[model samples]
Target: MNTKAEQTKGASAGDIGKLTLAAVILVAVIVAYTWLGNGNVPQPVRLIGLLVGLVVALAIGAFTGPGRRVRNYIAESQFEMRKVVWPTREETIKTTAIIIAVTIVLSLLLGLIDLILKSVILDWLLKLG
Candidate 1:
């Protein structure tokens, strides 16, 4: 018996159709938002429409046969993401500080070289004058 985990494949055409339907609904919402002329449509209603549409699409995906597997796969992926080990605050700060220190040092070195070249050029120009 194989000890490795079995890999789940992507959705079939019918499942893709369900996903496409959901995307079309999202695009329609965007089109509606833009069509409101002056962006003054009540914000709450717009938000509600988006939420409702998403819920309905998810419901359809869950209930439909092909969509069910696709939706389940997505849910499983999200669950897996929750198990990730994120960097600690101290580690993040240390990395950021190192980056900043390197950038400052490089900038200063470049500026000193630029000043030296400019001084040499100005002296050569004065001699020619």
Candidate 2:
């Protein structure tokens, strides 16, 4: 029995050509968008062309092995996301409030320490000079 890795072949020249074609199409889309000036083509028309070109290029790319892997990864991520037990709005708010309160208290403590250091260094040490 062939393992999943063994079942898959290395990228052939055809795959490279298809990926290159997709890249060329993407570049063409950018060129076409800019080449058609706003004075010649309406902004909406250019935008529509861009969207269509992007979709076509992406569609071509999605058939490739890497693209299929990306799709699988995204699907897995979405599936895993469904299993997450997200905190409620009340819990989030309370957590945020506690964090803010702690941060403020920490800041006050640090500021007091800094003030004491400055007083000791500048007031005491500098006066001796």
Candidate 3:
């Protein structure tokens, strides 16, 4: 019997192959659409090509067992992502303010040191001249 990890690996490989094939097919479709037309391809045909490619690619993932697993994996991942506890707007603003304040303070301190060093260097240069 195959372990869970092995099954997952096999499914991932199949998904990757399907995606690569889809990308190749999409590129071919785009090239034909562009070259076959006089100037730019019509908007409707382009949209139809995109929709067709999407449907075909998605079908590739649904028709096989590995494809079903890939779909399930995607759905589960989306569900898990929705459960994440994201930072609130207030927290984000507070973090941004703190970062800006620290940056300003450090910039002022560095500017003061740079001015003092420049004055000393100029004085030494004048004495040498």
For each candidate, what is the lDDT? 0.77, 0.88, 0.76
Q: Give the worst 10-residue stretch by lDDT in candidate 1.
A: 1-10
Q: Which pairs clash in the backbone of model 2? A: none
lDDT (Cα, tens digit) per residue for candidate 3, span 1-129 = 223563534445666777678768777777866775766668788778867877786676576666677677788788888989999999999999999999999999999999998988888876788
User: Of the candidates shown, which would achieve the greatest TM-score relative to the real structure?
Assistant: 2
Measured on C-alpha atoms, candidate 1 has an lDDT of 0.77
Candidate 2, lDDT over the whole model: 0.88
- Tens digit per residue, CA lDDT, model 1, 1-129: 234586567677777787778778877777776666367788778777777877776775666566665676787888888988999999999999999999999999999999998988888876788
Please provide, for model 2 over 32-116, each residue's C-alpha lDDT reduced to its tens digit, 9 standing for 90 to 100: 9999964679999999999999999998888887778778778878888898999999999999999999999999999999999
Clash number by candidate, in order: 0, 0, 0
Cα deviation in Å at residue 64, candidate 1? 9.2
The most accurate candidate by lDDT is 2
Candidate order (lDDT): 2, 1, 3
* Candidate 3 residue pairs in backbone clash: none
lDDT of model 2, residue 122? 97
Q: What TM-score, over all chains together, does every model reach? A: 0.54, 0.84, 0.58
Indicate the worst ten consecutive residues by lDDT in candidate 3: 1-10
